[model samples]
Target: MRKDKITSDELARLCGVSQGTIDRALNNRPGISPKTKQKVLQMAKDHGFIKNQYASSLSRGTSNLIGVVMLNLKNEFFSQLLTSIESTARSFGYTTAIMLSDNLEQVERQCVETLVGMNAAGILLCSVIPDPAYGKQLLQYSTSLVSLGNHICGEIPHIGIDDCAAMFDSTRYVLRHSYDHIYYVSPVLSRSSKENIDAQTQRFKGFEKAMALQPSVHYTVLRDPDTYQSILKSIPANGGRSAVICSSDSYTIQCLQLFKNSDVGIMGFDNPTMLRRLYPQLSTISYPIDAIGQLAVKTVLSPVKEQKSHYLAHTLISGTTIK
Candidate 1:
């Protein structure tokens, strides 16, 4: 009799009807007989089947589907992340349609529209999606969306690490090792009121705040791709200026490649298998990719049974790359 645990499926079974039929009847769509509709209503009330007004409206038209938009899927980190999300969505009996783009704004926008047109129950978004106006469009959808990444914003619920604090902790850890000239390499920041886009700004603020505490330490930022080699070539190998904190595993891997056996201490943001395998001693921040994926699925399917969204937490993993 608890309102929390009652489900649409259970209500449909109690009413001696298929889930689709119950859905149609409950959503007040045409097709089912008046008697069947009445039966479904009485049963739903008896079992305390709370209808998600949004899903009910959306369900009148299409199949249950979840759209996933991801960037850099070919990367090991994203590939692992996608696998975990896909597995979780499957467990909830949802058919997930995925769109992959190499961080192109145009392609990402197209993918979002395509998925929306498909009548997906909800969408799971990650990575650099262009067009700020599109974020407002998402809120209008009846589908429940959950963003998975450090960079996501808005009233829409998201699951990811606290980038500012995570990076601050990582940087403080590096400072504790007594390494000087700690540089943070990250993508250039963008201006937006949206919560997701604000992540980069938060991270930079964390770095600035942390740096202020230790006035003597030096830091610099490098976003230039063409002259990155020249920047790497300028660092001192044997001095106290021997450490660098990168924004991501992808950036760290690039740093490692550019400075092979160059004795420059390196660290990356996300802890990936390759980060550990290639540089077992590399210190980096780590969070559970599988758990993030699982949470995203749980959020999408929650409205199906009229469950509320839940917040998840992230923990940092320590390794040897710092000192």
Candidate 2:
């Protein structure tokens, strides 16, 4: 018989219990006898009686929904990564609930809380929590939870690239090209007890280290949007040979569009499909987005105690944009 087709009356008959008792046992209500609970659960296991999650949750007043919080769904890279995760979740017969927080720490935390309130079976967090105390508090919940891209550090399992290593490798690649004036553009960097890792800081360290070895190259870091636009305005005037690197593909792509003229070399992190197709000359680092999604679903469903931490490395996608 199809599991979803099974009803409470059928389960009660199978377990030799009253419908009321089965309801109490499944819902974890105090009135159900321990002996009866064990017998019902065992029978359910043997006969696949537990397969009807929707009906079961309806009787129990909640569900096994997997909640996902993505910080920047508008970013094409993140959107692709999230879609992969959602697809994996669906394959496992899990319903997904997604919340977008626009990369705000406050909104991210709220999204998590909202998911929990919905009785999530597990939560896949893809945002940085601004408050460490709340992250610690989140551990108290019995729900299975994991983080992606950004993580909650020790409290949660994460599936993502070693941001530090990816940035480092990308920077090293840029430096190897012998761009005399290498620059990095990033969204403003912020420090929080909740966010232990800084992707930009690690990337900057790589840039600095590389430049130190090559004393001849002049290096600069620009975070200002106005300065970025100003720099782009003068790219053609300065000559086409100089290179500019961006921490994000979106930023680099936007800057390139601003200049209109493809005189200067531009490289970005994250090998977005559109970027590669639109500007064949744009060099990038391919962060394994699909793999990250695949691993996240595997890790979240795996027993937390047996979960292993994985760090993916990035690959350089060289293009004619840079020498």
Candidate 3:
């Protein structure tokens, strides 16, 4: 027999035991004598036997693999989230199979289908599409789905930060600095597909709410592909105090570079380590990304019931950029 392709039946025959006994011994299932189990394990180890978890799961009609689907892994937040989820799932005796969607709806759908084909016990998805119909399709395959970052408008359990509250608090922090002009800077969604608009809309609503509370203050919203250039032109030439509250850390870092020599207060969201290391003075609302990962795993493993959404809290980390 080939050492690499050693099977349970082969091991059982060599050990003078039934295949059922070998299965029970290898999986640590009940109904096996300890002495026989030890002997079988040693013999299998000596013969270079390696159990196939996927095949075993297929035979049992269930899987211990948790599927994780997300957008591109270039961002620090997504990378950290993947690591946290993998680590947390392992503690629960589950393994993770991660797939990147590259922020494409079709890619996301394909990844979900592949995971379902693998019989993933549960899926933790950072969906590129937040449509109810798409969400329904996902539920048709498996009800054990936990959405991260963005929530679908359906009965899908969601684990993410309250974008409205996080942006509101970040806006208030910028207001406290007494800047005369406060601007909410976000990416222009005009080119984005319909399915990818929910998250941006939610954050914009929070910014609008905070701006409404201070009607007397001069505030504006700049939706631009080149936020730094637009913000630079918007600032008064005669040295008026201006501050920018960006919807993401990447935009905030760009704004920081734009106003490096000026006294402009800047606040961003998602306090990533790279931003902190490069610009220690940058202020941001730090979302509980690690907690989101842990909560997602717990939600996936729990018994399927009514869909529920979980909102983790965000912290406003004060830094020199916010003055």
Q: What's the lDDT for all of these models?
A: 0.70, 0.71, 0.81
Best by lDDT: 3
Which regions of candidate 2 fall more than 4 Å away from where they truly are? 1-55, 58-62, 190-197, 304-307
> Which digits, one per residue and each the tens of the lDDT, describe model 1 over residues 142-236?
66777766344465677766778877877777778777787777654432332235556666777777878898888777656566557766886
Q: How high a TM-score does candidate 3 get?
A: 0.89
Per-prediction TM-score: 0.73, 0.77, 0.89
lDDT of 2 by residue, 203-300 (tens): 65666665677787776677665566676566666643567878778787776786556556677888766666887767777888888887887787
Residue 127, candidate 1: Cα error in Å is 5.3
Give the per-residue lDDT of model 3 (tens digit) for 1-323.
Answer: 64664788889999999989998888788999999999999999888999888898889766889999988787788988898899999998788999999878889989988888888889998876845688777777753788887776558888888898888888877887778888777764543455556666778888888888888779877776756466555575636788888887767767877778777778888887667788776688887878888999999899755587888888888988888
Ranked by TM-score from best down, the candidates are 3, 2, 1
